[model samples]
Target: MATLSSFLLATSLVLAGCAGGGGGNASGTAGGGGTAGKPHVLKVANYFATDHPQNVALREKFKPMVEEKSGGSLQVQIYDNSKLGAEKEFYDGVRNGTIEMGIPGLIMQADVPKMAVGEWPFLFKDFAHAKKVLEGPIGKEMTDEMESKHGVHALAWSANGFRMFSSNRPIASVNDFQGMRIRMPNIPNYIKLGQLLGANITPMPISEVFTALEQKVVDGQDNPIATLKASGWYEVQTDVLESKHMFSPNLYIINGKLWSQLTPEQQRILEEAAKAAADYEWELLEKSYEDDKKFLQEKGIRFTTPDESFRQAMETAAGPLYDEIYQTYPWAKEMVEKIKAEAK
Candidate 1:
């Protein structure tokens, strides 16, 4: 009798533990705590400021959409303005699975050289053209390589807008570029572009840009007008040239391991939320340009829209840089051709 009672107690305890596990609303695909019916936490990181359209889109669209759609099984936490770390830091975190998600610029071009095309000088004709190419088949081709090589999966493409030149003096033509000190990202394309334009390039990270501008470490910096307003770089810049030399885009990526752990329904909800948020950011950013330009003007900053001649001159000077890129990467030439063809 005693032996039978012991076996029965053991069986009862085992059954109770299994029952306590709670079958977890399709989170059965995940391991450990996630299978115990706990809400899966996803941390989203980015360097964009809180008021910037990127953060606004994430907060208003992504968070609410994912949580509601998952019926409280998925929770999203967003860290904006380098709250977690700078672009590279969070990017590395995502790649290593330390961070669930990140919105980063094409900094991955350092590892994934093909990504450089995203920022090729004078490549994208306009906002619409860039968006079409990036969100179309070409973007998928590029991002597929990213998933296979790197450990992150691309969710959606967000807006960084076009790169504009901001300076203390007017840059109305190519002549103004000569001997000017300009800040550029350490990326070779950016440096080569600045060098081609006859400026002395000071390669630095974006985090250090404002101090460099304030201390006059460099004469000017180039970034999207949205970034100009978000980072408060406009306070130091007295003039802005709507140069639109390059179209910069941000990517919403999730760690491959974390993404794989999500159930199909959870993955679908996250992907849908990402696209919605990306579209939201794009709309908000486009509408913000004129408002940012107007605010900069009201702040005693001069805004210059370069004429067609000046634009042509800059593009002409950049021809060799593109030629050199084609020589370096066998696939680059074809990619550019495809991008241009698709733009039409």
Candidate 2:
């Protein structure tokens, strides 16, 4: 087995091939853009704010390591806040080989519907369980499938934790959600979950979420508390219902054709850098939850932990949606079952 260092070296070589011409931009060379001898410049596209802790953590932890290890041979250029277009657009860009890499949601069904298998609502019990499945065999299989079917290769999996609910009105039970309009990702499973819980679901891009709440386009939205605080949604919505629903797992993907063309040494470097960033980002996410909640609390955001009965009720109501997902992808169902069995 190749070590993590070997993976980054191999990835660097792959990136070099994508650049076509041998010369490298000074800005994209090494950390500051090195000389022409550098393998390739890595353009990393993400929709998060440049200052967001996760993004900061990723850069602080991974970028320098990749550059130094590659001896200023790989350049990493990060574009934040949808500079490379939104999540779906980034996915398409990677597929078309327009973008070298991006971190996109599993819900991008248009580009890779099979990847959406992991986003089925309420599939995970908690964070640890989520990590087990995502970093384990099931995720590996899906990652392999993505490379084969979509010309995308997964470098690592990052978490957004289990998503929760936030609204202007206090949401203590499923009853409180009745007639509420909740903004959700443009995914069928999300729509079904809202419907199951008696909320009118409004599907939209993540960028529009805060605005929708402020404009009353939706009465509520579901996401991790960390996101609600980080994105400044608390300014518009005062009440938070901590209903850990779906675990939003993001994929750090590179164009497969581009990745395959790299020399093994360069590839090794990119993989090492990605793994380090993944671990760093996840740790930041875990720590951010408490700090985020505390900050929201200080800002006068009301936090409501729903009763056990309500959680069970919501899960039961949404259970049928799982059946629909299973019907859509029987192989994923099998993989999920195997994961559940192993968790025992």
Q: What is the C-alpha lDDT of each candidate?
A: 0.89, 0.79
Q: Stretches of candidate 2 above 4 Å error? A: 1-38, 110-114
lDDT of 2 by residue, 1-344 (tens): 57988999999988887675445543345333222243778888887767665577568966787788777667778887788987888878988899998888775564566567567766777667777778887778667667777888888888777788989999887888899999988877788889988999999878888789999999989888877877888899989888887778887889999888776667777788888888888878877888988999999999898778888998898888877777877676776677666556
- The top-ranked prediction according to lDDT is 1
Model 1 Cα lDDT, one tens digit per residue, 1-344: 99999999999999988776766533554433332234688999998888999999999999999999887788999999898888889999999999999999988887788777889988888878888999998888777778878889999999899998999899989989999999988888999999999999998878889999999999999999888888999889899998899998999999998888787778888899999999999999999999998888888889888899999999998998998998988988889999998768
How many collisions between residues are there in candidate 2?
30
Q: Which sections of candidate 1 miss by over 4 Å?
A: 1-38
Q: How close is candidate 2 to the true structure, as a TM-score?
A: 0.85
Global CA lDDT computed for model 1:
0.89
